[model samples]
Target: MTYWQMRLALLRHPISAALAAVNQSGLFVVAIMGTALPAVFFLILLNFGILLDATQPSPSRLPILLHLILLQLLLIGLMRDAILGSKARLLLISVPGHQADHKVSMLLATLVNPLLWPPLFILLSTSPTNWPLMGAQWLLPVLLLGIQWSGLFAPAPSLVYLSLIFLLSLLPLSQPMATWLLSEQGMITLLLMLLLCQKLPIRTLFNRLQRLLSHLPLPVSSYIAQSVIRQELHGLVLRLTLALMIVAAGHLVQTQVAQFSGEVQTLTVSLLAVIAASWQLPLNRFLSAKREFLLSLPQSKICRATLLGQPLLLGLLLFQFWLHHGEHCWLQIGLLIMQISLIQIVTIRAERQFVLASLISTCAAMVLFVTLAN
Candidate 1:
């Protein structure tokens, strides 16, 4: 096959396509830049401080190297989705070709990915002396990256293997003592661990573990619903998690910091609104496909269960803050309620206008509430 056709075919694979899409949309670009820029900038400033102190040179270099390696590990590990990998493998199987050719094509397709290079460059630039050694070190990350890609397209058994290896690697990394010891072996050990974790067998293990867990005696319907909710609320979960962490940290500064309280509430409410608004378009498509299913259900049940569940999720978030602070901020609660209500109402009445109206109303409400509360 021609090069463009091969590239297109790889992209069509589930795992590769998602990665490519994530890379193309500049989400990965933004995330990497967001992470790397501040890190590098701050490291530069810190390096100057270390330069003035000649006594602790080794400590500084070691910590800097360790930190950079950790950052790369975090970025790659978190962003590698097994679902995407499975999808890619399916496409590979369907294509008529020599298996080796497909593997080579898949490898080359990864080269076009913006995600791979930026972090590699970051790693290289951060430790130029380590560059020559990185070929050896890179064996792990490259292997893991490739294995993750392979696992996506591989069979269930293969996914199980990959997952098991990942878990085993992670188990050691989790212990404080192990982590410190591993770091002492320096960049080479870290790179090897990364590569070993990336192998196809590891991914297969992971897939198998997931399948086992999924078959557990849980309420299948409820579990399915929750899975949907979690998938849809992924972005909101990250925002909430970060906001809660910040608010918890701020508690140390002052028990009754009005500034922290207001900032936390406003941010929490705004993020929920953004998340609710985002669901509008997707929900429309979902509802269109399942019009009959939705229609068969009682309006009251739908309103109470599905519709109210959306707001209640936001409410629970606000309630969490209230419980922590021990303050009945009616105004904050009202803003959150209104934000959720406004999004739902706009979504039902004018699906097309939901995005713009959601933004305008949420911003306006936040501004007014913050103004009056302060």
Candidate 2:
């Protein structure tokens, strides 16, 4: 097959192909909306930069910020094979190129996506004061790609190193170096990232998860059950990291919101819901297939079951506030719990358009609670 044919084969998975057939119009709408995100992001960032400059007239870090996000996306594409199902992995391996060449092709394909262009435009739209910084911005990808190339032999280490870079850069010690992500001083973080790219034991982590999961034999009564459990097991690291981030976000947002307003809370709750929804999606389908009676539950009963433990969530948030601020942050705690609970409830129960349900429910709940709080 030619290169483009090979890329096409890789992109068109069985599950997605079936879904496209089932809902072509919906899929087209989704594609259009997904493509529009870059435009939306570009306008938002461009205007924000303009507003900030109008207020204080400083050189913008906007380009560095965009490059950092692009770096993460590139790393995620590299990690895709590691996270995807065995079936997908097998199919990918069957594609007719050397692994390095295949990865290069995937990288090229990912960078060509229209969504990434907006950040460049956003940078360009900034004042000429940002031009010097923009020159440095182009080097960010080169540094990350260089680090990625150096770790072609150990994808796991490469990923772990990247994650560490992100985490450490958020720490106080790295703050001085964080200002310019592509300058010589900025290369400190990248150098530290490359140094940390020694072989990580990610395979061992997977092995341990498999051992524990196989001990109970994976609920293999059906394909859905088996696939759900396998994928869940494979996701232990990601799930754990997200959980930790959620916990930290819960505490950190009280401080962050003084600057960013409810956007931080909105994003935090949205993320918590997305993670919950992702887990619940396949599990709900598997259970509905297996028990069938779960489908027979009264709507009230289902709502009660899903919305259970609110008091606990509240208590935890209260404790999070005390842990971070040593006082009753009633407003913060209430807003977070309401937002998270509303989003999770919709995601768990709503059978169709999970994203829409979660967003509408969360937004409505947020508006209602904020109005009442005020």
Best by TM-score: 2
lDDT of 2 at 220: 23
**Error of model 2, residue 319, in angstroms:** 15
lDDT of 2 by residue, 36-146 (tens): 767545544553344223232222333334324334434344334432323455555666663655465446544543334444555566688866655544444455455
List the candidate 1 regions with Cα displacement exceeding 4 Å: 1-4, 9-97, 105-109, 130-147, 150-272, 294-304, 307-337, 365-369
Per-model CA lDDT versus the true structure: 0.46, 0.46
How much is the lDDT of residue 303 in candidate 2?
Answer: 38
Model 2 — which ten-residue stretch has the worst lDDT?
Answer: 24-33
Q: List the residue pairs that clash in candidate 2.
A: none
Q: Candidate 2, residue 101: CA error in Å?
A: 3.2
Per-residue alpha-carbon lDDT of model 1 for 1-374, expressed as tens digits? 74346545544564455456334422242223345767644434443233222243343333323333332232323333432233356655555653565465456545644335544545555557756654433443464455445433433433344344434423323334433433325335544544454454755566898799778885433443454565655344333333332333333223335656666556545554544444444445545565676566546344335633554465555445434343436666666667667776776676656556656766777688768866
